[model samples]
Target chain A: MEYPSRLIENAVGEISKLPGIGKKTALRLVLHLLKEPEGTTAELTEALTELRTKIKYCKDCHNISDDEVCNICASHRRDRSIICVVEDTRDVLAIENTAQYTGLYHILGGVISPIEGIGPSELNIDQLLQRIENNKNEVKEVIFALSPTMEGDTTAFYLTKKLRQFGVKISTIARGIPIGGELEYTDEITLGRSILSRTAYQQD
Target chain B: MEYPSRLIENAVGEISKLPGIGKKTALRLVLHLLKEPEGTTAELTEALTELRTKIKYCKDCHNISDDEVCNICASHRRDRSIICVVEDTRDVLAIENTAQYTGLYHILGGVISPIEGIGPSELNIDQLLQRIENNKNEVKEVIFALSPTMEGDTTAFYLTKKLRQFGVKISTIARGIPIGGELEYTDEITLGRSILSRTAYQQD
Candidate 1:
């Protein structure tokens, strides 16, 4: 549908480009922004602009960072020798929110998904390998803390085989159906638990 | 818990201010933005910044416009004598999308809500009366195309009482429960229809 004004249309277009925001929701958001003082809208715009300009991939862990190294990688108190491998930054944040882990992290940037044309070459796996090679003697464990998706499993297995030569300990999160989750909506947790609880991976 | 980086935190904080966007969704959106090239991010930032610099309210109708007067108000094809009152620019866009109305619009900026501390003084209602008085007999019907809510009703009633002194025709949109709506979620649309269809309000 045609917009009454160019400004409204432009605002909605920009908002709709955000993840999970459709045109209707974009329109609603733009209208809401219109009501607030001009400075508020300016502040949001300025922040987004600055976000891109100031942020970069941390050289040490590949997680988002304002400095050369991310906070997790730079912290002296964390277990530097034990790195938790995650598929993305959100997983890092999720684990951090629990305050249960105090280890360094290695962001894979993404998992191996052949369907999406993302293969081993596209990932920073070589950098990870180099890191492992350099720290082989000092490092104790390398936790495969990626999600329990098929791609996640594939990447984990691939890493385990590749790193077996380096003689580092590897582990994954214990899986089971989540509390308060329905059987149908039970994700990798339930599926992985069912598989693990079996004698071994066998024919259906 | 502390964020992996300050950049992620800043982006999430700004995005969370948007309507219906929580910190989680803001993170998702920020991640999406990160995947894009610098040009795309810059374009959106520039557009948002310029929106505030460019847009202004039309002096005659109070609708948002890039110029001294809005397109709808300035256009010769539109019926200048008829004015449609709406809550905001979004309503104007919705009605314009229908392509049914060819009249000018008066944006009240917002409706009357005592709890929100908004009243007639906060709105452009005085400018509306001034518009009618300035034009006198040239103005014909004033359509109240506001939302069918308690605040909307209060604003309409208040306007009707005030406009009665000016001897101008006033009308409201026909009401019924919306099409494709479940009965359980239906509000007082049926009640509104009964009241609107009442014969006493009719001039004939």
Candidate 2:
């Protein structure tokens, strides 16, 4: 669309380059920023630029960090022996929010997607292996917390093969009917898995 | 959710302030930016900041502009006698995309929303009146191209009252069933209005 101002068009065009944002959405967002106090946009700009430029990846898990090692990896209270391997920092945050796990994370950065030219080598696979090798005795179980996609499965299989030699127990997060899900609405594959993976129920 | 880094957290917080973006979406967007080349984030930040800080409003129409007068208002070919009044620059772009209009435009900046405490004083109402008074002989018609909302109708009613003494022709865009709208699916009020405003069909 022909914009009245080139600055607005440029701003919208640049913002629309982000994932899930379209031209119209970009315009709306830009207009919102324009209407807001000057400090708001300036703060947003500074924070984003600082995030991209000065941000560092955790040495152990490859998650975002202000320093060389992330807080989770450095914390003595966290169970570093049990590393939860996942695709990215978002997964790390998701699992952290659950409050079910108190372990360190290994961000794979990406899945083993050949179509996207991303393989095991493209991610932090080598760093993960080195981390395991250096702390072999301390590291006990490694959970495959990646999404239940084909690529996630392939990556898990590859990691399982590599981790077995280290004598570490490897497990995957369960995928089945959710806690509040109805049986009639559950998908066939999930329902089948739920039945197959059923454990002896213990009365609490 | 707890972020691994303060920078990432700050960026996500700022981004989540935008319309339609939540914490999860903001984190996803922030991670995507982190994965991309540094130049991409830098450019987006620069463009948005520049747009917010340097962009000027057109003196004549009060629309976004890089100069004192916007392109449409300053252009020699555009019909100076006719002016299309809209709420903001987005409407200007929408009408321009139609490729039907050749007239100038007046941006009201906002509508009269009593609940939001916005009235005629909040918009560019006085500037529009002055423009009409200064160019009384040259300006012939003023088109009310505002959206069809309660606030839009209220603004139109107010403008009509103010413009009656100017002796200039004033009209609103047609309101009825849309061009390709299905009759069965059309709303009651729109359908009723379409039937009431139906013109005599003449064989071409």
Candidate 3:
């Protein structure tokens, strides 16, 4: 169990700090790296160092970008008038991967969580409102694509109330049982769908 | 599919660089970090930044140390005469965890692998030799605690030959079929043991 020296221990210490990596796993990785060609550790080290230095957030949609603006926001092919508001940048990427939605996105950064002391002021809601007001001549629809959690719901309701004043159409992603779901195991998605689709909730 | 912003992607990229971490696992880790208080990312960033800065190799045995020498090398309680040579710092920790041995250590940095262009010259063999010569009056046993691999065996043999001139006792860890008896499923350990334990090489 004795290591060859301090160099390996330093490497293991750095590696163990990574997510899901315990000391044992870190030791395994360090051993594997030690067994590789001399330049392997240098490559991994360089990649890690550059990861933080070279990458940045897109100023517009907030997606990861090597440049000031992310590819999705800069692409003219996407619909500039419709904005899909999501909880995190990951959601933006997920929607983009489907190749079905061609609209620009607005990353809310996170949903409202009262328990965590996160309020409307802490979010990017002000910028969202300004974006809608500024783009009124061209913009049409705003989609709330946040998650189904309580915080997500709170943010959706808050956004709905605020954006109604902007005179723009707002719609939340439909909630209901997911596709290929069994009725017995159907989650609150089904229950929520039934509520949203109720006759009284519909416009007269 | 979309991330909330470039921050998540940047974090994910950083996480994925660690050994054994894939894109999905990286995402999970990033999400875990994101869910924490705002200071969590700062802590992770701080840990990574200080990883290389704070830790140093032990001057004598080459184990990791916060000071000039590692605890094991500086301690008066350890058997300084008995030096156990291992492949890396992780082995040092592993052996220490067992608490069976109280001797000093010599880290080889790595085993000799000709296929990988690593020769004895690339290892810390010279340091070990120098240590033995310098402390001729104090040194006694030098155990070769190498892995049971081809490269490990070759290095052990090579070290044994080189150290034979110095009149030091050199021995490798025991190798044999394991405790469990399943001839069909027996692994290399058992197989190697059965071969090594053979009466003698018989003439054909």
Candidate 4:
């Protein structure tokens, strides 16, 4: 589509570069920004600039942070002996929201996907190994909380092989039907796995 | 959701302030930006800043433009005797893309909507009237190309009442079933309108 102004075209071009956002949505957003007060655009640009330029990652877990280490890594109440390995910061947030896991996190940044040209070396695998090696006695368990995709499985397999030599207990999060999911609608693989991994019923 | 960094939180907060964007989507965009090279984020912010700061409106039609007068208004090829009144720049672009209309445009910026607290005074209706008054002899027609909604009808009605003394012909774009629209799935109102405004059958 032809834009009336060069500035608008440029703004739309830049915004549409983002994932899931198309040229139409970008134009709508740019037009919305034009309609809002000048301060609104200023604040948005300032915030994005600060985020891109000054944002830091936790030295230990590779999760997003403002300081040398993330809060989860620094907290004394967290179980430092167990590290929950995940793909990215979003996964960390999702697991944290559950409030069931008190262990520190090890953000691998991404999984080992050959199709995407992301290998084990491209991720935080070395940092994770170093973390486990530095406190071998203190770190007892390493839980793989990555997705159920093939890439996640490959990464977990790779990490398991590395951790076996260190004599650390390695586990992966369970794969099964979601809590509220109906058995009939559940995928065959998930239903089959759920049945195979079934536990004894307990009275509440 | 808990954000690991203050900068991430701030960026998400600002981005979520935009229309249609939520906290989750904002975080996803922010995280994507973080993963990309810093230069990408810088370019996006720079473009938006320049757009918000340097954008101009057409002096004659109120459409977005790089200069005081829009290209449409300055074009000698356009029909000066006819003016197509529209809601905003998007409408102008849509009409232009059709390549059917050769007349210049006067962007109302918005329609008359009492529920949204938008009155005639809030739009560029006065400028449109002034344009017609200044070029009374040259201008022969004023076409209303607003959406087929209550606000649009109200705005058109108000303008028609104002322009009654000018002796200029007033018209509106046809409202009916769109081309390529299936009759079975078309809304009753639109189908009824199509039947009511049926034109003479002409062989191609």
The fnat scores of all predictions, in order, read 0.67, 0.99, 0.17, 0.98
TM-score of 4: 0.97
Docking class of 1: medium
Q: Number of clashing residue pairs in every model?
A: 0, 0, 37, 0
lDDT of 3 at B192: 72
Candidate 2 lands at a TM-score of 0.96
TM-score, chain B only, every model? 0.89, 0.96, 0.85, 0.95
Weakest ten-residue segment in model 3 chain A by summed lDDT: A43-52
Give the CA lDDT, 0 to 100, for residue B21 in model 1: 91
How many pairs of residues collide in model 1?
0
Q: Specify the CAPRI tier of model 4.
A: high
Classified by CAPRI criteria, candidate 2 counts as high
RMSD of each: 4.4, 1.7, 7.2, 1.5
> Ranking by TM-score, best first?
4, 2, 1, 3
lDDT of 1 by residue, B1-204 (tens): 467667678778988998789998888888888878877788787777777677788999898887888888889999888889999887888899888999989999999999999999999999999999998888898999998789999999999998998888999987765578666676676856655685565677
How would you encode candidate 2's per-residue C-alpha lDDT over A9-74 as one tens digit per residue? 899899999999999999999999988899999999999988999999888888889999989988
DockQ of 3: 0.16
- Residue runs of model 3 more than 4 Å from their true location after superposition: A1-75, A172-204, B1-18, B22-59, B66-69, B174-188, B191-204
Chain A TM-score vs. truth, each candidate: 0.86, 0.96, 0.82, 0.97
Model 4, span A1-204: residue lDDT tens: 889999999999999999989998999999899989899999999999999999989999999999998898999999889999999999998998999999999999999999999998899999999999998899999999989999998999999888888898888899999999898999999999999998789989
lDDT sort, best first: 4, 2, 1, 3
- TM-scores vs. true structure, each candidate: 0.90, 0.96, 0.69, 0.97
